[model samples]
Target chain A: MTVRSGAAARSGARGRPGAGGRPGGVARLVVRTVSEVCVTAGTLIVLFVVYVLFWTGVRADSAMDGEIGKLQDQWSTGPVAAGTPGATGGQPSGPGKQPPYENGKSFAVMYIPRFGADWSKPVLEGTAVDVLKKGLGHYGRTARLGETGNFAVAGHRRTYGDPFKDFPRLRPGDAVVLTDGTTWFTYRIDRRPYRTLPTDIGVIDPVPRESGYSGPGRYLTLTTCEPEWGHSHRLIAWAHLDSTQPVERGRPSALTG
Target chain B: MYGWIWRHLPGNAWVKALVSLVLVLAIVYVLFQYVFPWAEPLLPFNDVTVDRGMGAVR
Candidate 1:
């Protein structure tokens, strides 16, 4: 909003040079160019902030919704062959079974009542950068839905639809439900989110020592960046499988409620 | 700098204004569509993964 910037500066510069003659022209032009450059850089930085804080959310909302819709369409057309290629036709969560979902492809949808009744995000197979841009990502090496060991998932805490934006709102008994077209798996949180360094990979181990579980059991790990918009640390939450029901038996009460 | 561009914009006041607006919008579009997407991965906001690939554990 400076009066001496932008289009207005042209006339000002032309007239102002008359006061000092040609000697001031070169210095005036240099100062003007430097100021213009500074202003343009400032504008770009502000635009980048807008793109990160707002435009990204806009793009990610649609991307996540598109992924969810694609999964639903695939599930409706061919429930068995849609995902879990080898473990088709029957329940895919057979204790030791690993529902080897296609990498970068969404295989399930997760719903957290603590976030909101309508809050749901597709769970992709891998945690790679592009994969998470669509929605939540299932840690490839972790347990599959309702299976033994740790069924861990990761999601954005700030952008990319902010699937776990309210991750800290989770309570000890809050329900985290997910479905893989054939069954609904509900897990209850063991505690609120625990803040830790980004290097704490053991929090997703089969028997996470920090999760209060002394033995191996069906566990769920949710991870996101700490400090909301900062990734200097991570926020983790552990849950244990509470129950499972066939998809035909209707959605688990955890979701319907 | 902007003053020079405005002087050479070759139009009436209204047309020059329209052209300037379009140019600015085009630059923003490219930034949002191409530049921002490419730069996002370089930022820390999207680092949700536990970095198991780094072999850094605590």
Candidate 2:
């Protein structure tokens, strides 16, 4: 009986308490739970970063392609007249006289040779986030293409194909070409990218107060986020109207160069 | 805690693993679809503009 009782006592000690009642068991449980939570949170943060940086670019590229196709179809159906002032070999046209574009409507395609030979993105009216996601967005209050005053545009530098990813590489006299299905408007980069505040609306002024120009003239302003990944500040590049050419005249010297 | 969970859990090791996976997925889905979306605007991710000496720009 004594041997049997000792065996039973040992079994009891091993069976239940050893499984759940060990000293510091609660502390171990707490530490394990906290660590698991941290690991889960860390994984989630990584996934979110991937979604923002990589997935957005994929979605934006496809959307931009669709917008370009639609613009091409529209232009093909209603080709602009040849030999107009806005066309090749024609004289410079007057200001604010070109066709009016509706809000969110795509009116032209912008090319920055510094970006790449095949780099072109649709220019759509409005600076709304949704609009910029599709492609480069034109400031609604700014001047029209090839017109007097500041024709300002904005785009993302990090996501949505990062249209302005190489904006900083643009040097003075670099070409920023735009086409409205009829004529090509070439603007020469007059200033390298300058850092500015987002509220500095003066950068998009008729004369662009920040551009150091006091008088009204045909100016182009390109704005994007600084640091490539963050939007805490804006990087702006200023340009002036240099020339105009028709599609029939073929690509401009700026494009060829 | 894990030992307690193991003891309470029914069936074999595979059953426990599958249940744990499903539970983890449910928690992640809830956090992503509801908690994170609700908390995003409160974060600073949308503050695209800096406050220059002049004032807030954006």
Per-candidate total of colliding backbone pairs: 0, 5
**Model 2 lDDT, residue A239, Cα:** 93
lDDT of 1 by residue, B1-58 (tens): 8999999998899999999999999999999999989988888888787764652331
lDDT tens readout by residue for model 2, A1-257: 99999999999767766676765677777899998789867988886666566766787789888888898898788765444443544345675556556888787899888899999999998776567778888877778777667788888777667788888898998999998888888999987788987677788778876686778777899988776766567888999888887776888898886
* Candidate 2, position A151, lDDT: 84
- Candidate 2 TM-score restricted to chain A: 0.83
Stretch of 10 with least lDDT, candidate 2 chain A: A81-90
lDDT digits (tens) for residues A124-231 of candidate 1: 988888888889988877777766688889899987777888888888999998888877788899998999988888898989858889987878999999889888
Which candidate number maximizes lDDT? Answer: 1
Candidate 1 segments whose C-alpha is farther than 4 A from its true place: A1-20, A79-99, B52-58
Poorest stretch of ten by lDDT in candidate 1 chain B: B49-58
Q: Which docking band does candidate 2 fall into?
A: incorrect
Look at candidate 1 and give me any clashing residue pairs: none
State the iRMSD of every prediction, in order shown.
1.4, 4.9
Give per-model TM-scores: 0.86, 0.75
Interface RMSD of 1: 1.4
